[model samples]
Target: MVDLASLPPQLRRAVDDEMRRLRAGDGVLYGDMTSEEAHDLESADGRALPPDGALDRFIAHATVPPADVAASDLAGYTLVGVVPEGPGLDGPWSSVKRVYRRPDGVLVMLHEWAYVAEGGGVLGVRELMNASVRHGTARCPAQFAIRRAPTGQTVSELRWFTDAKVFTLSVAQDVLADGGKDHGKAWMLRLAEAIE
Candidate 1:
C-alpha cells in the first residue's frame, strides 16, 4: 500500500494534487466530473483541518498506490534518479521528495535532497552544498571523501558535476568496513566516477 505520511506538507500536497488530476478527465480521459469537481470530491475525505487548513493529507485515503508528482521543478529533478545500483538493484524506490516553494516564489531550500534505499544499504544524494551559480546555473567539480562526522561515524560522500547537474551520493563507510580507509576512499572515488 502507498505510504506518504512522512512527506513534508508541501510535497505531500503536490502528490495529492497530482492524484486528483490523474483521476480526473484532464489526465485520464475518464472521470465524469470537472477538475474542480474531482478536487472537491477528494477534499470531501478531509475533516477539520488544523490552523494550516491542513490541506488534504490523503493519509486517510484508500491504500492504493501513491501518486507520481510530475509537476514543474519537482518533475525536472527526479527524471533520472540517483542511485548506486544498476537496474532494480535497490528494490522499488520510496516516494520522491523536493524542496518546497511558497506560492509567492520563494524556495525553502536552494538544493534538493532524496534517498534511494534505506537502513544499512541506503544511498542518498543531494544537490551540492553551497554551490555557486552563474546565470542561474551551478555546477560542481568532482569531490569525494570518507570523512568521519563529528559523531565519529564514517560516511561515504561523493560529489560530482556532470550533464549540467551537481549531485552528492553518500552511504555509510561500510563499503569497506573490513578494508581500511584507503580502500574505502578508492571505492568512493570509483563510485563517484560511475555516477552519471
Candidate 2:
C-alpha cells in the first residue's frame, strides 16, 4: 500500500485515478503478472536480457548483487519486472534491473551494472558522467537540475555511484506536484542498502 497521505496533492489524485482504473479491470496488476512480462514492459527500449544468463554476468561485474531486489525491500510495492543488458562472456558485459510499481501507476526502477570505460584504462570525466551515476568518485558526475520539460513540468533526478556500480532511481517529476523529491530519496536509500 502506498502512503497516499504523504504524497503531494496532485500525485495523490493521480494515484487515486489509477486505482479506479484498476478496480474497473482496465489493466493488470504487476503482482499478478509473470516476472518476464514485467521485464519486457520496462526494458522494451534496452538490450534484451532473459533471466538465465543475466544474473551470472551481474555477479561477475558488480561489487553487489544488482539483481537481488526482494519483496522485503519493497514492502508495499509490487515487483513489476526485471531486464538485463550485455551479458556476453567478454568483459562481463551485462547489467541487471528490477522495477517496482506502486498500487497507482507510479514506478521506480532499480538498475545496477559495471561501467564500460571507453578508450580503455581510466574513463574520462564526461564519459563516466554520461554512462553511469555521477557519484563523487566518477571521473565526471552527472549534473542535475530542476529543469522544465516540454510540457512545462519540472523534472527531478538524482544519481550516484557506489561500490563500483551505478544506481539511479528517478520519478517522473510533475510541476503540479512536489516533484517526488521525498519519494526518490527514500527509494535511493533502499537501493543503497543492497550494495555489498
Task: At residue 131, give the lDDT of candidate 1.
Answer: 24
Q: TM-score for model 1?
A: 0.26
Misplaced by over 4 Å in model 2 are 1-64, 67-75, 87-93, 116-155, 179-196
Over the full model, what C-alpha lDDT does candidate 2 score relative to the true structure?
0.44
- lDDT tens digits by residue: candidate 1, 5-77: 5567886677666445333221111113345533432332232123131212322221222233343233333
lDDT on C-alpha atoms for all candidate structures? 0.33, 0.44
TM-score of 2: 0.44
lDDT string for model 2 (6-110, tens) is 667987777666444322211111112235534443443244344355555556764334534443345566555555555454434445665566566565555
